[model samples]
Target: MPAIEVTSLSKTFRTKRKAAGLGASLRSLVRPEFRTIEAVRGLSFEMEPGELLGFIGPNGAGKSTTIKILTGILFPSGGEAKVLGYVPWKQRRQLAYHIGTVFGQRPQLWYHLPAIDTLTLFGKIYELDDRQTKRRIAELAEAFEIEDLLETPVRKLSLGQRMRCEVAASLLHKPKLLLLDEPSIGLDVVAKQHIRDAIRTMAAQENVGVLLTSHDAGDLEALCKRVIIINHGQIVYQDKVSALKRSFLTSKLVEVRYAQQVGADFRIAGTETLKVAKERYGVKLRFDARITPVGKVMAALSAAGTLVDITISDPPLEEVIAAIYQKAENRE
Candidate 1:
């Protein structure tokens, strides 16, 4: 059976609407206006054992709501779903033993206590045997490379260190599935790599199925084999990560510093000049790699002026996602 399964699952929230004036706010205190918002609209997907799937969407696009529903934090408004063979909202206590969750913005570790303390506390909450908890803690500390920081106070640990511990704490009970929300947000490159490596190791060694929600494309590219993108509470694209990149990631950005001044009319075919600092002899250009070969663009720029420095890079992941969203919107 799939680790997670959903069939036309949906959620709607009732929210109070307040008008924008002091008088309106005061009047609303007596009787509040209400609105119904559909946070998730008939979404359906499944995750197999040991699968690393990327669940992504723009802000307010229902990613969090879907995760919350699956994790049993909230009940869905309609349809059916199953996680680890249990209805999350109906059997939340039973399901809790089989799943792990890590929210980047929310720290589960006690702020003033050492991570070890929290780990022990979670062990007792999960009813893990004392001996088993100690062994699991040691194993996780090694896997996450947090053995040295285990005794350090949560408040004193660096963000990266604390995040590593947070993930470790979540896995003390050896969950079969993991729900990760922006696990790499606000992390530096090195720190992000550490967390990614640990997650990869856990999935490989424990065969843990991961449903990951992250804005960082690197995380998806590095860890996920499949990706599902949603917009306006509906899926816009779902495919292998490789296929998504091949279909949409076609543009490259190039920056060049010329040794000699460039003329006002400097131009090249299949490339658009994004910026030019005439005084400093610098120019920025963008082109579709699929339409215009990088070599040809470089050759044209090189011939135009003596080059002091040049750098070429792929377009940011945000732009690629935006283009996908635009394509989806246009199709609708």
Candidate 2:
């Protein structure tokens, strides 16, 4: 069976409307105004065992709501859902043993206590025996490279170190499904890579399915093979990461630093000079990867001046997501 299955799942929230004026407020006291907001609309998807799926969307696009419903934190308004063969909302307690969750903004570790203490507490909560708990902790500490940070107080650890410990704690029970929301948020590049490597290793060895929600494109690119992107509470795109790039990634940005000064009039065919710092021997250029080969651009740059340093990168993921959203909006 698939690790997760959902058919037309939806959620609606009832909220009180604000009163505008004093008279309106007084009248509202007698009878309050209300509004119904649809947070998730007819969402359906499936994840297989050991699959790394990227569940992504813009702010308030129902990403968190969908995760909450799947994890049984909130009940859905409509539709059928099953995770690991259990209805999350109906069998939450039973399902808890098979799944793990980590919300980057919310720390599950006790602030004043060492992370090792929290891990022990979690082991007890999960009903692991004493020997089993110690063995699991040692394995996780090694996997996450947090062996040195285990005894450090949660408050004293750096954001990256704490995050590593948090992830390790979640895995102590050897859950079959892991839900990670912004796991790499507020982490440096090196720290992000560490989390990614650990997650990759765990998923491979444990055969644990992962549903990762992150705004960092690097995380998605490095970890997820398939992605489901939602906007306006509906899926706008779902496909392989490579396919998404091929369809939406049309341009490349190149930055170069020359060893010597270059003229302001420096130009290359099929490329646009975005910025030119003549005195500093720095230039930023952009070209359509679909039209002009990156090899040609590199050759042009090399011929222009003695190259000191060069970097090439795709456009930010936000830009790609915006383009997809705009297209979806236009179609509407």
Candidate 3:
């Protein structure tokens, strides 16, 4: 059976509308208008056991709403979902033992207490034996590099440190499935890598399925095998991460540094020069690999001057996702 089975899953929220100005507000209070927001609509998907799935979108794209519904934290307006073979909203209490979650914007750690205190409390809440709980804590501390931070007060820890602790807390139960919403938010480059690596290791070791949502493209590239892109409360694209890259990650960003100064108007054929260093020794460029082979660009740069450094990368994940949204909107 699939780790997560969501069929026609949907959630709609009704918000009371208030007009501007005191008079209008007063009248609205007497007869309030409500706006119906379709946070999730007709969503259908399934995640296999031990699968790493990326569910990503822009702000207000219903990523968080879908996660919450699957976790049984909110009632969906319509449709249904089963998490680990249990109906989410109907069997939430029973299903709680099998899943872990981390919401980036919400704090699960105690503000005034050290993170260890919260972790220990979770051990009890999850019914973990004291001996096993200690062992798990030790393992997670090493994996997350939080042995030192665990003792510091959560309020005293930096956002990155606290986030490491928060994710560790979620894994205290050694859940079979993880639902992470923006797990890498507020994390720096190195910190983000640490979290991704740790999560990947833990998932592999335990055969845990992961459903992750993040704005950072690096997270998806690093952690997920498959990705589902959502927009306006619906799925716009779903495919293997490699396939998504092959289709939309066509352009490459190349930055190169030379050992000596070059002409200010330096340009390459079939490539766009995004920037040239003020020192005249370095240049930033972009090109479609399909048009100008990567080997050609490298050869041209090599022949120009003694190479000092070079960097090549794909366009941002946001750019690729935006293209998807545009294509979907045009079709609609």
Candidate 4:
């Protein structure tokens, strides 16, 4: 069975609108105007057990709202949803036992207290016994490389250190599912890689299904097998990461080296020459595989000279996401 099933989920928020003038504000207090914002709209999707799913979107795209709804933090206006065979809104407490969550902007740890203290508190909340909690903390400390930081006050720890603690705390009970919303938001490249590696290791060890939402495309590429892209509170694209790349990540960067020096002008038909080596034996270029097939490009390159070395790589995922959003906007 799917670990998560969300069908026709929707959330609407109402905010009181105020006018410019003081008199208008006073009058609005008596008869206030309200603006209805559709944060999520008829969203439908499923996640299999032990799958890493990426839920991504621009700011205000309802990614957070959908995650909150799934985790039972915010009740949706209309929808039927089941997470781990339990309806999240109707069975929040029961579902909490089987799921973990991390929200980037919110700190779950005590500010002045050590991270270990917060972990202890969570252990109690999850009903873990003292020995079990200690063992789990030790294991997580090793996995996340936070054994030395656990006793340090959360406020004293750096962003990366604290984030590692936050994730470790969420896994204290070994939940079957984890929902991470921008857990690596403020982390540096090295720190981000550290957290990603730990998460990958733990997910593989425990078979935990992860539903991650992040602005960082690198996170999606590194952690998720499938991706769901949403914009303006609705899904625009949902597919396997490789399929998304093949479909929209059309552009490719090619670096080629010939056995000997070729002419100064190193160019190829249907491909844009980005740069040529000063000695003129190597060239770098780009092309859309959709327009000029890989086979054709390779054949053309071989025809130019004896191939010594060649590397072909796709454009960055950020570009693919941007292109998808722009295409959606153009359609609108």
* Clash list (residue pairs), candidate 1: none
Quote the positional error of residue 226 for candidate 3 in Å.
1.3
Q: 1-332 in candidate 2: lDDT tens per residue?
A: 99999999999999988768899888878999999999999999999878999988777889888988999999999998999999999999999999999999898999999999999999899999999999999999999999999998999999999999999999999999999988998999999999999999998899889999876778888889999998777999999999999888889999999988888877889999999984859998999988999998899889988999999998987789788889988998
Highest lDDT, which number? Answer: 4
RMSD of each: 2.4, 2.3, 2.3, 2.7
Off by over 4 Å in 3: 256-267, 276-281, 297-310
Question: For residues 67-185, what per-residue lDDT tens digits would candidate 1 score against the true structure?
Answer: 88998999999989999999999999999999999999999999999999999999998999999999999999999999999998999999999999999998999999999988998
Ranked candidates, highest lDDT first: 4, 3, 2, 1
Steric collisions counted per model: 0, 0, 0, 0
Worst 10 residues of 2 by lDDT: 213-222
lDDT of each: 0.91, 0.91, 0.92, 0.94
How many clashing pairs in candidate 3?
0
Residue 144: error of model 4 in Å?
0.8
lDDT of 3: 0.92
- In candidate 4, the residue pairs with backbone N, CA or C atoms under 3 Å apart (3 or more residues apart, or in different chains) clash, namely none
In TM-score terms, candidate 4 sits at 0.90
Residue 39 CA displacement from its true place in model 1, Å: 0.7
